[model samples]
Target: MALECINLEHVPASHTIHAALFQNIKNASFLHQQLLAGNTEFEYALIDASVIISRLHALAAIYRAVNDLLGNKLRSRNVHSEIVFSLSPNNNIAESFRRFGISPETTSLLVIKVSTPSSPAAGEDIQSHLSKVVDGEQVDFSDGVLRAMTDMVRVKKIYKLNYSSGVNGRGKENAVYGSDRTSQDSKELEMLILGSMALRGATN
Candidate 1:
């Protein structure tokens, strides 16, 4: 897997992000434990790939988290944890962690870290660190890879999606661009989730 360097819109140069996707992870518990223990070396955002629908899904959360970090409105301990929180439709921090954070059963994983002047030059060494600690094969971060990893049933349950009827928990009110749900695909589903997440932060 390669470290994807992203220069987000309006975000400062120092906030550039380096992210990677992995699969067949074997030490998820240990990785999760490291995060739980607040290990500085494991500052990367370790996400359960099964819950991520696409690269955009992951990016949207990252964008929100970084935005919050820049604004000093972060609801979690840091930008990494905020990414997991941004993925949730609702704003329950702990539940978001439980659902999206890495676990012993998590086979596919996504790792993200940010570059800043004050922080260690972790982005440059991300691939090496991940290779040493994560027992998994690195893969290109793409929608095809994420799509295969996504759990449709659990995704629907988490987002309260009912695509069979093209409505969600908020019904037509939550649909974006007035698009109906009858012909939804991965693209439409992604849009719906993004819309909901946007509204969530706005309301908060």
Candidate 2:
């Protein structure tokens, strides 16, 4: 029952999102297979949590995907898959899926289901559906949970960031919050990476 229904800013009311974080998943491979098989019941965006740095890092990707969906500009199969694609800095859809999508070994997971006017399912309905299929303990979708799930080494590698001291792009280092070095730098890196991924769908 750890599912959260989030009302996004600027998104239409008909597009409420249901997001959940799962830990110590026992059926990751099964779930991954379901997605690969194109099971209609497994339409939720299943993300590998290790590549995520914070809730906003995940939210930024969701925002960009949903925004594109609203504009009829989806670059992938659907909004759910596009959420994973939006996390990548490049436009390679399959690579994005391979990197961010669930795998056989993924233990920590992020599940996102968008309820649009075309497919309006209540939060309770989505929660019930996930609870039955996903074999993991649901937890709050907060920064603390997400931070523990993040793999710093993998995140830097995925984004091709040079150093761990700080993120280098769009003057983000200068824009970093004045706080503890480790945590503050991580936040900056997440922000910088989010900005980088967001720029992929930018329009003139």
Among the numbered candidates, top TM-score falls to: 2
Estimate, for each residue in 1-204, the C-alpha lDDT of model 2 and write its tens digit. 567988889988889888999999999999999999999988899999988878888888899899999999999999999999999988889999999999999999999999888888888888888999999999888877776677767778888877665433322343443448856667677778877786764631
TM-scores for all candidates: the values are 0.87, 0.89
| TM-score of decoy 1 | 0.87
What are the per-residue Cα lDDT tens digits for candidate 1 across 102-173? 988899999988776678465558877888999998998987677667776688888887754333322122
Relative to the true structure, how large is the alpha-carbon lDDT of every model? Answer: 0.81, 0.85
Q: What is the C-alpha RMSD, rounded to one decimal, of candidate 2? A: 4.9
Mark the 10 consecutive residues where model 1 has the least summed lDDT.
Answer: 165-174
Superposed on all Cα atoms, the candidates' RMSDs to the truth, in angstroms, are: 5.7, 4.9
109 Cα displacement, candidate 1 (Å): 0.2
| Residue 135 shift from truth in candidate 2, angstroms | 1.0
